[model samples]
Target chain A: MSLLSVRSLRVTYGGIEAVRGIDLDVAEGELVALIGANGAGKTTTLKALSGMVRPAGGRVTYKGIDVTGMASHHLIRQGIALVPEGRGVFARLTVEENLAMGAYTRNDPPGVSADLDRVFELFPRLSERRAQVAGTLSGGEQQMLAIGRAMMSRPRLMLLDEPSMGLAPLMVQKIFEVIQSISAQGVTILLVEQNALLALEAANRGYVMESGAITMEDAASALLESPQVREAYLGQ
Target chain B: MDIFLQQIINGLTLGSVYAIVALGYTMVYGIVQLINFAHGEVVMVGAMVALWVITALAGSGTTLPPLVIVLIGTLCAIPACMAVGYAMERIAYRPLRNAPRLAPLITAIGISIILQHLAMLIWSRNPLAFPQIISNPVFHLGGATISGVQIAIISLSLLMMAALTLLVYRTKLGVAMRATSENPEIAGLMGIDVNRVISITFVIGAALAAVAGVMVGTYYGIAHYTMGALLGMKAFSAAVLGGIGNLAGAMLGGMLLGVVEALGTGYIGNLTDLCHVSWISSDLAERCAVDGHVILFGSNYQDVFAFVVLILVLVFRPSGLLGERVSDRA
Candidate 1:
């Protein structure tokens, strides 16, 4: 059984449906990527899975239990964390405080501390400026803090929404490397990104979404070589 | 020198009261971002309730001590004001949260008016005098006249401000409050109940304002339905004068504004014809030629001076004395 299963997830904003009956599943310890253009419902799918957006109709099953409309924070406690788009760091809080806030639900003091050290190790820049307010950080540093914060939650499934968005090319590579390292440590990753080439290269499996529906699903290797995906998204 | 000392003490006493009341305005604005115009009415409610406590004790005829009665009054007023605050948030403000921001503001104004009338209808527009024993206690300090009421007001205000500062900075609730103020949606995603935090913020702010109300009532020996209007406006100005969302800034602004007003009144308003009109138009070297003195203004214009300072402060430093940068989230 897959560690997470989202079946026929449908989310609407007023009369407009953002995610239209999409089905996706994340196996335990698997690296899956969802790639799409702007407004292609990639974000909507992540939000539905994290319970930030209530699905109008569908089932979000994590570890065989249906958790469709659970509150987002409650889901975080249950081991799912979503690093929201636009790098939603608490701009006023220091980097350390931001990390502490992410671990709010966890009371295991030693484990949380160890995880903090680990995050700092992974993103040494965050450790260097641990006392700095997140808002003042450069785009790359803020993205690192955002990802590090989600890691502090010790999530079983990390839903990353465009971790590479607005990042320098080198920083983009670094972020993907971190994603790879995180997945290698038995943490399942469901990465949503517009950087189709990098995301597919880093991911084992890929799903291409267009206008609120998944139009293609294939192994990352197949999607990389496909003429249609290349002509449409990779800007061949 | 003695008179100056006395005025300074008096300013400190009054400044403490404004500091306490200003905190309520600041905290409510900090979390919910609502001006909560009905907050002044919460103070009026406190005074009325305290009056009732005094009356109940006195009517019982010698069983409960006066201090016990005062405590009872405080307890009654705190909860009463808190309930009113919670109701205001839940009923009047919560429904309009998603509506235009101006809608809640208008509703807040309407609530303020309703509360004023409600105070009049219940308290009958007659200002109730606080008990004589509590109101008239006096102490002489080194040629400076200090009253027991003033001491209590000062001490109580300090204690409340200290407690509020601790609550904002030290506790888990405080952490949640800061988070809510910073970003409600993100705070919610982290398991903090944003709505409940906001409601609690209003309740706590209202409760503190109630404490200020009771103190003002006891110190002045009178509680009137309309008492909160001017005080509320002043407290609101104090909040803005000190960066509104900054808690420490509110206290600092309140005390500073109080002292400035006192100095202006003491030196400027009370001075009669001390300013020779020739001095106004003359250089320092030519000032000796002035003959007649002209009165610029009168002490009754204290409120106008306060507003003038307020305008100057606004013009120069639009963010207030303490600058706290706000993120444009909503």
Candidate 2:
């Protein structure tokens, strides 16, 4: 059974439909990439899944429960976490505080502390700047902190939105490696990205989204070779 | 020199009161970006509740110690004001949270008016003299006399501010609050209950307002429905003066404003009286010469100083003295 399955899910913003009856699935432990151009309703879809925005229509089931339109905090408590677009780290808070906030729902102090150390282990640069205010960090460092902070939640499924957005090539490479490492640790991931090739290469499977609907879905390598995807997304 | 010392002491006492009240404004503003114009009314509510409790207690002829009666009064006031504050958020402000920014502001003013009237109806329009039941011993140092009331206000304000600072920077809930203030949606994604944080913010702010209310009433020996209007405005100005969302800035702004007002009042008469304004008008100059003084303004204009500093701060540094660089982003 799929860990997360969506049936004809629709999302609207200000009377305009952003996600149009899109069906998708992510089985447990699989890395799924939702790739699309800008304004392809990718972010909105993630927003709906994470309960940031109310779904205008349809059903979203996680682990066989109909969890449509749950509050963000409720979804988060059920082991779902979103690294929102633009890396929304609390700017004025220190890096340590940011990570601590990620574990706000957890009451097990020792376990949370352990998870925090694990996050620090994964991102040494974040460990070095743990005491620094998040606002002062560079864009790359902020993205790293954002991911590390999300990891502190010890989520079962992680939704990443454009982790590579606005980062240098080297930084993007570093981030993708960290993401693949996270997936290897048995946490399911649904990565949304504008960078088609990068997302597809890191993903186990891929879906092509355009104009608020899914156009195609295939193995990551198959999507990489598709003529339509090559002409439109891969810049061939 | 003695006068200078005395004025400084007076200023410290007054500034601490302003600081305490200003924290309420800043904390609520920081979490929810609402000025909460009715916050002063919450202070008024605190004072009124304290007055009611003390009056009832004192009249009942209970054997409770004087200090115990005062403490009971404060205990009663804190929860009452907190309830008032929470209701204001849940009923008036929360419904308008996503409405146009101007909507909440107008609603704030409406709540302020409503609260003032409600207080008037409950407490009667006449000012109630807050009973000074406990014995207070005054202290003297360096030719300046500091009353026990002044000492209590200053020390209590300092203690509260310190505790608040520790709470915000150290605790789990504090981090959740900071997160929610920064981004409510993202904070919710981390399983932090944003609404609960906001409600708690209002409650904490109201608690501080309660203490400040009691302090203001005790210092002046009276409580009136209208007292909160000017006090609230002054505290709001102090919050803005210290950078609205920054905690430390609010405290600094409060103390500085207090000192400035005190010093301005102390010297405005002296400076204006000695001035020879021949350029203003020949008649005025002649009058000054005949009377040997201008005597333009005095302690009655002390309220003018707070507004003047506010205008000057707005004109020169609108972001406030400690306003952070908000442009930093990912």
Candidate 3:
């Protein structure tokens, strides 16, 4: 059974539809990528699935339970976490505090402490600047902190949005490596990215979205080699 | 020199009250960006509750110790104010949270009006004389005199501010509050219940305001339905002066504003005397002078000084003396 299943999810902002009747599923331990251009409803779908945006229609099930319209914090307790678009680090908080906040729902102090160490080990730069305010960190460091924070939640499923946006190539490469490592650790991932090539390469399976609907879905290698995908997304 | 020292003491005492109240404004604004104009009404409610409790106890001829009576009064006031603060957030502020910024602000004003009228309806418009809970003799410090009440006000304010600082910077709850203030959406994603954190913020802020309200009433020996209006405006100005979202900034701003007003009231006439404005006609200058000093300004103009400081701070350092804790717009 899939870890997460969204059937005909819809989201609207103001009077306009953003994500319209889209369905998707992520099996346990699979790294699935959703690739689309700007305004293709990729972020909105992620938001709706994570409960940040309430779906105007359809059901969201997690682990075969109907978890539709559940609050974000509730979803976190059920082992779902979203590292939001633009790396939403608490700017006024120190790096250490941001990581601490990531473990907010957990009451196990010793476990939290161990997780904290693990996160620091995962991102050594965050450890180096643990006491520094997050706002002062560089964009790459902030992105790292965002991912490290999500790891502190010990989520079974992680939704990553635009992890490569506005980063230098080296930093993007480092981030993709981290994503690969996280997936290898048996955490299911649903990644949304406009960088189609990198996302498809990192993911086991990929789905193409256009105008608020999925246009194609296949194994990542197949999509990577497809002539249509190459013409539109790979810029080859 | 003695008069100058005396004004400083007076200023510090008044400043402490403003600082405590200003904290309420700063904390609430930091999290929700709501002005909570009704916050002033919370202060009034606190003072009224304290007054009612103390009066009832006294009327019943309960011979409690003065310290115990004051403590009980404060204990009563804090919770009452907290309830009002919580209700304001849940009933008036929460539903309008997603509405345009103007909606909550206008609702806050409406809440303030309702609170004022409710107090007036219950407690009446007459100013009740606040009983002296601490009647200790005044002490002398060099040239300036210190009343037991003034010392209590200053020390308590400092203690509360210290406790608040520790709470905001040291505890897990403080981290959650700060996180929510920084970005509610992201904080939610991190599994922090933003609404709970925000509600707690309002409660803490209201508790502080309650203490200030009780202190102000005790200091002035009067409590009335309308007393919070001017005091609230001054405290709000202090919050702005310190940088609306900065805690330490609010403290500094409150004290600075208090000192300026006190000093301005004491010396404005003398200061004006030193400045000879040629624009003033000789007849008018003569009429404005009292005992060879131009008395264009006096203690009556003390309130004006707060507004002047506010305007000056707005024009010069809009971010406040301490820069505001503004989050990055995602």
Best by DockQ: 2
TM-scores, in order shown? Answer: 0.90, 0.96, 0.95
Q: DockQ winner between 1 and 3, please give it.
A: 3
iRMSD (Å) of candidate 1? 1.5
Residue lDDT tens for model 2, A1-236: 99999999999999999999999999999999999999999999999999999999999999999999999999988889999899999898999999998888889999999998898888888899999999999999999999998898898899999999999999999999999999999999999999999999999999999999999999999999999999999999
| Native-referenced DockQ of model 3 | 0.82
Note the DockQ of each predicted structure.
0.53, 0.87, 0.82
Better of 1 and 2 by lDDT: 2
Q: List the residue pairs that clash in candidate 3.
A: none
Range of the 10 consecutive residues with the lowest summed lDDT in candidate 1 chain B: B284-293
lDDT of 1 by residue, B155-175 (tens): 888888899888877776787
lDDT of 1 at B7: 68
What fnat does each of the candidate structures reach?
0.50, 0.98, 0.89
Full ranking by DockQ: 2, 3, 1
Stretches of candidate 2 above 4 Å error?
B274-294, B325-330
Scanning candidate 3 chain B in windows of ten residues, the lowest lDDT window is B321-330
Candidate 2 per-residue lDDT, tens place, B30-80, comes to 888888999999999999898889888988999999878888999999999
Residue B60 lDDT in model 2?
Answer: 95
